[model samples]
Target: MTADTSVRFREFKMPDVGEGLTEAEILSWYVKPGDTVTDGQVVCEVETAKAAVELPIPYDGVVHELRFGEGTTVDVGTSIITIDVAPGSGPAEEPAAAEPPAASVPTPTAPAEEAEEKPKGRQPVLVGYGVAESSTKRRPRKQAAPSPEQSAAAAIQAEMNGHGAAPAAPQDRTRPLAKPPVRKLAKDLGIDLATVTPTGPDGIITREDVHAAAAPAPAPAAEAVPAPAPAPEAALVTAGARETRVPIKGVRKATAAAMVGSAFTAPHVTEFVTVDVTRTMKLVEELKADKDMAGLRVNPLLLIAKALLVAIRRNPEVNAAWDEAAQEIVLKHYVNLGIAAATPRGLIVPNIKDAQDKTLPELASALGDLVATAREGKTTPAAMQGGTVTITNVGVFGVDTGTPILNPGESAILAVGAIKLQPWVHKGKIKPRQVTTLALSFDHRLVDGELGSKVLADIAAVLEQPKRLITWA
Candidate 1:
């Protein structure tokens, strides 16, 4: 019998995961050159415009090469990995020809049964099946080869050697060199990479180098160039006009398009209600001093988040999506509470799933982790999906109030204004107390004005008197 043979080389490119994202930064590579990979095997981790995503191999084969190294930013449709599918090998193969059709050749159905009954050499495709259609699941820790510290050390060593490492190489670029994470930190802070002086043992860039870069640069010497003779009045002398052009990339670009789209598409109706949050603020102070809540970042937002969860339980209509295709209003029982954070990469709303089930301390920890991940641009795509409702804290920016647009899909969004001490009439007497405004914006189609107003009032009532949360719960 002849040996079945056919070699196919398949190139795997990064796909636009979602949210109209264009480019992504490679976080780590799972398979190295020359390794055998299976279909649906995670090849690398990437950070898109919204969250971190894992890219899987589409076919099983020997990995020919990785096009981009960790920390390199690659555009969509760019080939990231190559696989060689060698013919007639692995667990799959063809069967031997049988004798004259016996009762329809018994319709030889099962591959395993045929293999056992006949002695035919069969070859299967490298990856048994195609890539999984669902989003890649994240392992608790990535299975990539190099540890973060090792990658950092190697990067430093390469930098010291004078020759720059190939941009696609994944060996740690951080050396007595700067680490990739640190380099990322610098980039997010607008620190110039070249100007950051290394401070490590081998003159490698260190965390300190990045921190130093974030510091304000020393003022340049006030060199007095002999002043050019003053231009004559009305002489059409240009005042040394200069225009600076900043390239739109990363966070800035993503935020701009989302804001414009949400603003126009959603019929936004922002209604504000002032609340006396003195009790909520007092609870924050108590939680801050509690020994059990040691590491948690307890703040007014935690209480507000809890209040929102309770209000949502009473008003499920606010937590829903408008499905235009199905022409139905989809209601959700579980809450994925999105917290709108003003990160260096513009504004991002990464949510906490099943937030209603978490205790106050648990909510505090979740908020802390979400903020840290968003700030580092490491929020994963899953975290950004299935958000039922959103909260934007303009108060953080010291602004009293703002009208926020509803997140795409979700029917409602709540904005918390800055909390300040103000003289207000309390129980018929004017007194100084902690006061803030709560603004609720809802989709006129899914959530009516009455429902939106009720939700906003319920949240305010909880903040106005912290004990209401317990009763509602």
Candidate 2:
């Protein structure tokens, strides 16, 4: 074969993947330079706005190089991997040519076709489509040979001698049976997986088992590290002049400016209310089993969302925004409920549009969809706009409550707290009940204390007796 026909260097560029996302953060590199890879082999993992995706290589060849390092943000259409492709030859190279753009390259062979045609048990290259299709034709089943008991005396004697020969030295049976990744996790967590009883199927060690075994033992005060020593004469090179700088970029910069603007310009006032949400917790449990709410994530946030919508109807002032230029309170008839989700990127408050129009089941589904999309980083800019009020679920992070800063153009924000079972007075008898705290922060100029309290109390009352939601509706 001619040189051009024998070998070709195929460049694999990062695709949009989906959701029209322009950029992604490189989470990891599965292959490095000089590593031989096959089509459909996973080359790296990229974190998009919505989810972590494993990017597969599109060609069969040795990985020439990874253009971007882990944690580096790369734009779509950037060349991520180069593969030296050769026909028949195990490894080969070709003379350099002017690089072609990613869009000009033809689609590589599908992973399913390659898998069925390739030899059994061979690891495929990183390039190409993922997930091979199953074969349609089934091979004929094989029959086993007759047992030694059915054979002659000489055959029985031979079998007995084979069994008696050393017995495989009692192979290290104490060591746990785990995959390489699980074993790596155990090592990283300082866990002795062998000693940790396996709960996985077939007595295999799992990631959770490793984590549980590696849990740090609580220590007394005596074992705690002491405070750092005072600075020495040489270390005090510039006393009272020490400073550290951090670049304000991405989420940190955006959050900082928003916090400052909200605090200084919005005239904020925060009020706290503790509520017995036992009924709400019980209702959540019931909804989780409900056929109507199937596949929806039933949680306190859903109830809180419903309560907030109801309270907004009762006290519309809480949802009203301050219009400085117009010198008016922009009262919204419909609620666009904003949910503040803390993602890998930072604090992103994406909202549900016209949330007041949704029923309980519809709201639950919307919340589920919203959360799933947000976590995957697929929440559109339009979904994040026109929010009248917001709810920040600090409870997910185990925080009891915090005074949340208002999203720009919104009037109020609510912080949901962690729910815990605590002893409470029920009809003069002490009973264990699920309780939670709610912190409401509002622009004082638009919302008075009476209005804020009423809004909060209305939400608490619904949570205290979730059945009230039906009656209130």
Candidate 2: where are CA atoms >4 Å away?
Answer: 1-247
Candidate 2 structure quality by residue, lDDT tens digits, 1-473: 44462237677778886546687766556654445667787777776554456777878765544555544567888776667675334323322344554553332211222212222332322223332322222122245875665456655566687864232432242224564456546544435554677887657677888777756562111101111243244422232346533334444456678788989999889999989998888889999999998888788899999998888888877888888999998888888999998865567788898999999999998999899887765565557668889999888888899998999889899999999888999889999999899999999999999999999999999999888788988
Q: Worst ten-residue run, lDDT, model 2?
A: 218-227
TM-score of each: 0.64, 0.54
Q: Count the backbone clashes (under 3 Å) in each candidate.
A: 20, 17
Worst 10-residue lDDT window, candidate 1: 219-228
CA lDDT of each prediction against the hidden true structure: 0.69, 0.69
